[model samples]
Target: MDRTPSFLQQHKQTFQRVGAVLLAILVWQVLAMAVGHQLLVPSPLSVLERLAGIWLEAGFWSTVWFTFRKIVAGFLLGLALGLGLGSLAGRFPLFEILFRPWAVMVKSVPVASFIVICLIWMSSARLSIFISFLMVLPIVYTNVLQSIRSVDRQMLEAVQIFRLPWAKRVLYLWLPQMKPYLISACSVGLGISWKAGIAAEIIGIPSGSIGQMFYDAKVYFNTTDLFTWTIIVVVVSVLFEKGFLALLKWLYGRLEKL
Candidate 1:
């Protein structure tokens, strides 16, 4: 019998989730009808219609792709830098001290302030990339560094005593030890990257971006368009997180099997 849990058993909850979503949408539709103003709150059907319209347009995919590329670029860059810096910080007190202030500032300062300040240094063209990077860096770095620092000392002593090969040390010692923190960091960082990237694009209004569409919708008071685009962002963000986390977990499973 293939008893392995191929994935987390969430299938049973699917019906519940669908019911909850339907209920929420019903509530929203009723509220919108009571308001009697599309501008105030668009009906669910109208928003779905708007979504269909946008989906049929040629530029829709292009807009989604552009924003996706920018956000992913920044997210990967931040994740790479964080992993590197976190390793250094974990190993050396001086390195950790040097990074503490920067990490703290990145986590503490409002994202809007960073977006504005970044405008002075770079054009709006790359605003999303930079903003997303800034948003994700501290989170990934902090989690990874803390994980490394808290690695089981006994595990390390055993590895040293056995004089295990570097490959085994990494595969056996590090991956298992750091998997939870790594997953946590990625989960949080990915969400922040999307939010910050979109916010930056909204403020900067770069051409051909999802954020620009939002701005145009707001300018014309197109509630349907706004709601449609907002729903797209949420769906895309959620899907990306789920896909990426699943892939990471799958890889971890393979490592464990080894």
Candidate 2:
């Protein structure tokens, strides 16, 4: 007989999530009615209708795909560079010293400043990639460096005593120890990448981008379109985050089994 709790069953949490979403939409509708101005706050129904309209447009899909490609490209590049740099910084004091100021600056500087600076240096089409990379780099670097520092000294000593190969030590010990930090870094970095990338696109207004649609909506004062596009961004970002994190979790499971 299956002894699992009912709460742990499939679709239990799904139903709860759907109920919560419906409740939130109802609250939003009530609040919009109370406000009595679509400009100030669009009704949920109006936004949904706008979303449906946009969903039928070929241009909408193109813009979404363009923005998505740039965001993903930037995120991956930043993730790779961050992992490499963090490993170096973690392993060598000199490298850490050299990179510390840059990491600090990246972490502390306002994203708007980065966007403006990048706009002057490159075409609008590439701004999202650069901005997203900039936003994600320090996060991944800091988290990974911390993870490396936090590795157990006893484990290192054991590896040394066994005279294990460097690759073996790194694979079995270092990578396993850093899994939590890597996961945390990825979660934070992915969100930052999307936020900063979209912000860059908005400011730059590149053709064939979600940001351009947002800009056009603002220019025309189309509140419904604006709300609809904003919802699309949120939905896309959430879906990407969920998918990426699930993949990360699966990778960690494989690593653990190894």
TM-score of each: 0.93, 0.92
Tell me which residue pairs clash in candidate 2. none
- In terms of lDDT, model 2 sits at 0.90
- Worst 10-residue lDDT window for candidate 2 reads 3-12
**Which predicted model would earn the best lDDT?**
1
Model 1 error, position 4 (Å): 21
Instruction: List, residue by residue over 134-200, the lDDT tens digit for candidate 2.
Output: 9888988888899989988998899999999989988898888888888888898888899899999
How accurate locally, in lDDT, is each candidate?
0.91, 0.90
Question: Candidate 1's C-alpha lDDT?
Answer: 0.91
lDDT (10s digit) by residue, model 1, range 121-199: 9988799999999888888889888888899999999999999999898899877877999999999999999999999
The true-versus-predicted C-alpha distance at residue 176 of model 2, in Å, is 1.0
